[model samples]
Target: MGYYLMKFFSWVACRFSMEKCNSFGKVLGKLTWIVVPKKRKFMAYDNIIRCLGVDAGEAERIAKASWVQFGPMLMEVLRYPELIKDDYIKKYVTIDGLEYLQEAIDNKQGAVIATSHSDSWELMGAALAQYGVPLVGVAKKQKDSAMDRFINEYRTLVGMHITYTNGVREMFKMIKEGWMIGLITDQDPLWSDGVVLDFFNRKTNCFVGPASIARTQKAPIFHGQIVHRPDGGHHITIYPPIFVDQTKDKKEDIKKATQQIANLLENHIRTHPEDWFWLHDRWKSVREKGLD
Candidate 1:
């Protein structure tokens, strides 16, 4: 039932121009909030206050904006098949720091695009695709099979290759081809398998895969953020790549790489608190699992 509903929504989203679709998305977001803010409101409040270190009032404001962004965000994501067209790319996306990404590829070292859940992150991939980068991204499989297929297919509508989180062999093959693989380095990883890192002054388990991959593949790590402009367009600012050191100590290398990624994400979130998705219990590893 829900899958069909999403399919309907996707079809409707693609019918309108990107600007009109985005406007409709904001309306949807407001209706969603007014009708059913849902239980994530509690978690969103906690995350903003705990992670951003803001007062209750300020945290609530940031949390609300974050939730409000969902309408346009969902619209943008579902509009991928429509938005990835060449004309839309030139009309709406403003790309900067492109040379940094190109330079990494020029070195013959595959680059791991260290990404996070930011405003309009889905568009980030499409924007890069417009620039002719062979994109490969890793994501966890959705529990709903039909929804999973629907989502991933649209996710790669702009020429990206989406792989499951456990697709190690395929990732290795892509690395050998010097493809740029995108990994979200900020998600809370399993305490047992992940390394502890300090994010927003709190210790939590973070995925070390990007760092490990870079070290093993002799690749460089780069990060980007898609900031939503007031005019309804997005500007992607790609940061320079950070290379991992071959210090002989594997764990130490992982620690260094993970910290670099963590620090970079923290800075972006700090500078733009409302732009980040803060609904998830990102500190669960420390507060719940006692990773600290």
Candidate 2:
């Protein structure tokens, strides 16, 4: 049932112009917010209020807007087949800080891009690939095989090299080949595996994969994000790279690099509250372990 539903939506999205699809997606997102269960629904609101220090009214507004963006996000992802057309990237996606990415490629030293689950986040990597950057995105495999296959196909279709979370060896190979690697680091990691850090003033466990890779591989780490413009386009901003201090203790260096990423994510989310994936229980590890 889940697989068929995804296929149906993808089919519907492919048949419409992007503008039309986006408009329809807004309606779909609103309806989804209304129908999803209470726990799932309130999680977004809670995250906004507690983590962001927003009042209830403002948090609710931000929560709903995030939900609204979800529809357009899914629709845009499903429309990747059309997005790969010639000149599509040039028309809709504008990139800043190309020199940062270019520097890595030019030097034959691949870069680790630290990103989050922001609006049209998947599109960031795909757009770069479409613009001629050799990119491999680190992705978590969905539990449902159908959904996983559906997404991976489009990712590859748009020229993105896909690797699962456990494929660390493969990532090193890609980095050695000077291919940019995109890692979404916003989600909570298992308590045992993550490094606890301060996010929005709250303690939470964070994945250190991107930082570890950059330090070990001697690659530069750049913070990046894609924002949805008012005119329904996307603008990708990549900051200058930070080289992890090899002189520092290994664990301490990883923690420091990870903290820098958390700070960047907080800044972006504060500026664009609705862009981040608030639906996720970002502090789950802290809550589960009864950490203060």
State how far residue 156 of model 2 sits from its true place (Å). Answer: 0.3
Please state the error at residue 25 of candidate 2 in Å: 0.8
Q: Taking the tens digit of each residue's C-alpha lDDT, what string does model 1 give over 1-292? A: 7678888888888888878878888888767776544567777787777777788899878877776788888888887767766568756889888898887667655778888888878788878877777789787899998888877877777778999988988888898887888887676778766888888878878889888988998888888888888788989888887888999898999889889988988899999898888876677777786554
Q: Which candidate is the best by lDDT?
A: 2
How high is each candidate's TM-score?
Answer: 0.92, 0.94
Against the hidden true structure, what lDDT does model 1 obtain?
0.81
TM-score of 1: 0.92
For model 1 the local lDDT of residue 130 reads 73
Taking the tens digit of each residue's C-alpha lDDT, what string does model 2 give over 1-292? 7677877877888899999998998999998988867786588788888877888899888878877888888888988878877778667889999888887788888989989989888888888888888899888899999889888888898999999988989999999999888998889887666799898888889999888999999999999999988899999999888888797599999899899989988999999998887777777779888974
Candidate 2 runs further than 4 Å off: 1-11
Give the Cα-based TM-score of candidate 2 against the true structure. 0.94
